[model samples]
Target: MNAEAARTPLFDEHVALGAQMTEFAGYLMPMQYIGIKQEHLAVREGCGIFDLCHMAQLRVFGTSAFDFLQYLMTNDLSRLSVPGMAQYTLICDDDAGIIDDVIVYRTGEIEYLLVANAINRRVVFDWANMIRDRWSTHQPCGESAPRQGIDLEIVDETDRTGLIALQGPLAIPLVEQMMPEGADIPTRFKILATTIGPTPVLLSRTGYTGEDGVEIFTHASNTAAIWRYLLSFPEISPCGLGSRDTLRLEMGYHLYGSDMDRGVDPISARLGWICPADKPDFVGSDAIRRIREQEDHRVLVFFTADDAIPRPGMSLSANGVEIGHVASGTYSPSLCVGIASGYVPTGYSRPGQKLDLQVRRKQVSVVVVDPPFVQGTSL
Candidate 1:
């Protein structure tokens, strides 16, 4: 591990379990407990627990919190009419370039919990603070003074909070076992203020893997206790970043740096669904609208190969001409094949298009398919 790398609250627990740790996004995280394939299969067939403390957690609250977020996020915040509703939204720059994809949980009428990717934590925090400061000081041109600046506060809770995910078909049942009697279990895409044992947590029915699960957020001090309790249920396996990557790849989910970045807009990334046209104008609304009107030069596509596994940076070509490079690639444990996603010319991004993937020494034939290489999971 790098000398500067940070460790999560469960680092000691992982070390004691003989997990292979690696530095990822400035955090020393478990790469694997036993093996990627074993952990991957565990989530597909049963349950897997993951330490997600590396991800950033931000809290936004106050009178103007809704308006502040409404102006910054591409998705409509009004959909969260009540508390405990979680929405996946994209934070974009003025030019509609994706800054980061985050999930916002409406924890209160004027408060929300935003969860962002670990690697983009600082970037998101800085950008949000800059915007918040500017928005708080803006005065109308005709007004003599700025109306009482919208009341708002953005707090970085990354260091003080710990996140854990219990994923798979058995995840909900296992969580229910720990819940107080008569406590309602949060349904998919929802959240609940609940307790496990004596520790209070914000439990949300969400996950990156294409499976049914819940992510629990609690005080950093309570993380290890929760992790140990979850693992005590013999059915739950401790998963690492390796299986997390493979599981998400099989579902055709996008990774921030790989599938998108400051240079890529949501329209070209096949994530336009998150940006509804009926919503009020936002920071990137104008730029996104322009991009949506024009034809996309390159579009993201998901593909699979039978004989060879695709790897990131591998060349993707067609008719003996290079088109693009693999953005994310991995061997799909469930499908028993290699699956990858990359950007290619819009003309060749259809589901049945054939492309050639340069897998090391040989060119392997690949077929562009609709998202989710593996199906019939417990999602």
Candidate 2:
């Protein structure tokens, strides 16, 4: 660990358990514990616990927080009007380029919380603050009085909070056991403030592994105890980033920097689903709408190889013509094959299209396939 890298509250526990540490997003985090393959299977077949305190948690509150977020984010916040509801949204720049993919939850009638990738948290915060400053000086008047204005507060609660991701098919059952009597776990994509073993926790049935699970958020001071409590169940295995990446790869979930960056347009990234068409004006909405008018030149595609492992930055070609490069790739322990995602020309983005992935100096045959290469997930 470096002298400047941030350490989560569970860093000591990870070290004690013999985790292979790595520096990611300015934090010293566990890359793996027992092994990547075993940990990956544990999450697929049973349950896996993850230390996710490195993620950022920002709270937005006040009378106009909802409207403020609607203008700043691509997804329609009106859909999450009810408390406990959550939605996956994209924060984009003025050119419709992806800034960060985030999940926002309505914690109260007028309060909301957004979780951003650790690397982009500060960027998102500064962007929001800049918008807030502009809105404060140029509040719309007359007919736009009730609707187009902003008076919200942003709070950075990341350092004060700790997060744990308990994921898999059996995750719900284990969490149910720890909840207080007469209190039921929230449904999918919902959140609830509840207590577990005397500690107050914000439990949300949300995960990146495409599995049914809950992310528990509590005070940083209580994370070690909560982590230990969750692991008391013999069926739960402690997993790290290595397994987490493989698991998400199997489900075709996008990682922030690898899959999409600020320079990438959301349409080409296949994240248009999160940006609804009927929403009012938002950041990059006009540009995105214009981009949708034209045919997408390149679109994200998924593929699998028989024996070769396709790694990031590998080139893909069709008939000796370069198409695109791999964005994220990994070996699927469950499928016993290599799975990868990359951008290709629209003509070659269809499922079943054949392409050659350049591995070292050799060309490896790969077939494009629709996502979720391994199905039957709890999601």
Candidate 3:
């Protein structure tokens, strides 16, 4: 493996457990530990830990930090005023197409941490810099921390932060077992600054699995010890990218590049809630405004089927006319059905909307339905 290819601290552990490794986002991460099916089952039945340290962690500070984020992002961070709160925001290009999506965690009054997907690190950072530069010369970052640049001078990306995602039904219990006394796994969507054994870890009740889980961010120096400690939990198992992808797709959630991209806006992605009428002009406000007024087409409707499974870029047709195409899909272990989400005409967004997936030489019968094909033990 190339040293600069980037790796999570659990590289050795994943190899020891016999993971199938693959190159994703320039990282030699595990594609699957046992197998995608088995690992997917484990997350549904028990719990799983994923090494997510390769994802980018960006810090924006200085006096204009809040204002900078507002100008670039769609969601209003002002509503996320309380400490230990995390809100999902979409970064849009000038055309209102999604440049990327990130979660902004307000860690302090003037300091904010942005969690961006690994593939679009440079794109997001450059956008952040443009916002800072356009707003004013008053940089919001702390003077002491040199803006260790990736694609921008104002964005200070810590050289290292080890993040572990403890997911599945038993995630809360497993994480609590490894945490200190005051580390309360209190409710979903809340972030707590706590410790795992002796290491300071930021534990957040958020996950992509459509399960009740916690994502713990800690310093890289302590990752080895924490990995060993967390593995000791009877309910917590180790999972890799293969299972993670299937799990997220099973819930009808969007993946960054594959499901959403620069060509699509939130309305077409079934993410209309991200845009509010009263919110100030974000990057893509004008483009989205026209899309909304036109109501030209509907976003992808999620669905499940025992037969006729769909994959990304596959054709979705109605009668003899091609109406839409699959954006994301997977074989759901829990639902025992093939599930998918894709774009269709505005008239077909409702349930029981009949459509056909032109898979191979055959047209498979499919009907639109709701998501979370399987129920989570918690909400």
Number of clashing residue pairs in every model?
A: 0, 0, 7
Candidate 1, 1-379: lDDT as tens digits: 5999999999999999999999999999999999999999999999999999999999999988998898789989899999999999999998999999999999998999999999999999999998776656554242234547578889999999999999999998888899999899998889999997678999999999999999999999999999998888999999999999999999989999989999999999999999998775677888999898997578999999999999999999999999999999989999889999999989999999999999889999999999988889899
Which structure among the candidates has the greatest TM-score?
1
Which has the better TM-score: candidate 1, or candidate 3? Answer: 1
TM-scores, in order shown?
Answer: 0.97, 0.96, 0.91
lDDT of each: 0.92, 0.91, 0.78
Error of 2 at 291 (Å): 1.0
Model 2 CA deviation exceeding 4 Å by range:
137-150
| Top model number, lDDT | 1
Per-residue alpha-carbon lDDT of model 2 for 244-336, expressed as tens digits?
999998999999999999888888889989988887578888888987787757888999999699999999999999999999998999999
Q: Could you give the candidate ranking by TM-score, starting with the highest? A: 1, 2, 3
Worst 10-residue lDDT window for candidate 3 reads: 142-151
Q: Enumerate residue pairs that collide in model 2.
A: none
- In terms of lDDT, the poorest run of 10 residues in model 1 is 138-147
Which scores better on TM-score, 1 or 2?
1
C-alpha positional error of residue 61 in candidate 3 after TM-score superposition, expressed in Å: 1.3
Better candidate by TM-score, 2 or 3: 2
